[model samples]
Target: MHLIAIDWGTSSLRGALLDGKGHVLEERSHSRGILTVPAGGFPGLFEELFGDWMRLTGSFCLISGMAGSKQGWVEAPYCPCPSGRVEVANAIVEIEPGRIAIVPGLSDVHDGVPDVMRGEEVQIFGAMSLVGLSDGLFVLPGTHSKWVTVKRGRVTGFRTFMTGEFYALLSQHSILAHTLDAQAPLDEVAFLEGVTQADNGQGLLHNAFGVRTLGLFERMPAGELASYLSGLLIGEELRTQSIHGGDLVLIGSPALTQRYQLALEVSGNTARTLGAEATWAGLHALSAIHIANKARS
Candidate 1:
């Protein structure tokens, strides 16, 4: 049997054609993500992107991320915390009779903070498998960064930070807009300087002003403001998260994860990175569990 996995998010749709063993046989993606699809057009767009793969016999489609949200093709409900692969598999919703299933997101109410993740759970589990870790902190850096805790092979809890989105909003639309160059090359020294500032007890709002002042004073080049802001926001996000200070696995784009690794290192933590293969591995894992469940029934 083969598994066709789709990571359908707000901005893009990623699909993978994987063999029984979870190796990717073929893959494709498109910019027409869930947000771009017209009302009630998910099925049509899905067929357009992955119809060939679905046409094959014995192929099962597994989707994750916002495609399972209230706005998706069909709402796949969320699974609670302390969940493992089996829980996620059991929660899968069959959207297309016996052919297609959507993996459920995970929710946690640890420490009075209500946190939820859609596509990131798949990435976290895949990253855990890639690193061969039964327990640790997993960081997925993006618009909504997720800091997840895995214990005894189950997802214990996690938190979300809007660092990336904040950076975008502040840089592009806020008062510091003129100080940033969207295409500027990263200035490592300036970035580290911002991180150092973040640790000085100045809150983000107070520290953010430094971007404009420094540029105004010709102290830091306007071209390098992006790097400094990146460090400041990322540094603050790391500072607030309650990581126990051990090995942290970062799963995301190479560039973004590398930025996070640098911030973690500055905070006296060790980190490693895994890329898209982990998402594929995760979707494959859940799909395998679902297949087993089907056989049992």
Candidate 2:
């Protein structure tokens, strides 16, 4: 059977039509994420987006990400952690029974606090399928970066970092905002310097103030200072992880993953990168399992 994979995020939406063999026949993307849709508009909007593809014989669909959230079309409650394709597939919430469904997000508890993710789980599984490894450290960088660990294809646990969000706040609203140019590209030298400063034993709060001082002392240009601040924050995020493997998996956009790969290399590590297509691969994989199971039941 063919597959229609939709990754509906908070700010954007992506869909793909994959042939039975998993080759993409067509794809579509839009900025009309769940947040843009008005109350009770998901059903109609979805039909408008892919009503044609759904009409195609043997085509099935799986929706992932925030599209299944409480605020989304219909809440597909999160599946608990230690989940694999089997567990996730089994929990698939049917939006149109046998035709369309929403893949549930994964949830885990850390130190008595609950942590959750939506679309990132599929990417992790897709990375697993693509790289042919079920166990490794998978990092998905974004506004809320995720550090996930998998053992034999099941996600055991993970952590979330507000690194990107912190960057935006510090670069735009903090006391150091005036001292740096937030729009600057990555300045490798200054960026690494900030990365190094993150490990100086002074801690991030203490080290962050140095950005303004450097500006005051004319130690760095505005653009370079921005890169430095970025490196510092990303470096601080990296400091918490125990990265030692050669087969580290970094999944996300090139711009974000590039920064992570650079940071990892500086710490004597390497990683393989995967793009957004991993989302489709993951959804396709899950769709197969889900369809097969449904047939038996």
Quick one: best TM-score, which candidate?
Answer: 1
Error of 1 at 291 (Å): 0.6
**204-224 per-residue lDDT for model 1 (tens digits):** 999999999999999888888
Cα RMSD to native, each candidate?
1.2, 1.3
Please give each candidate's TM-score. 0.97, 0.96
The lDDT of each candidate is 0.88, 0.91
Poorest 10 consecutive residues of model 2 by lDDT? 239-248
Q: In lDDT terms, how accurate is model 1?
A: 0.88
Give the lDDT of residue 259 in candidate 2. Answer: 88
* lDDT at position 261, candidate 1: 79
Clashing pairs in 2: none
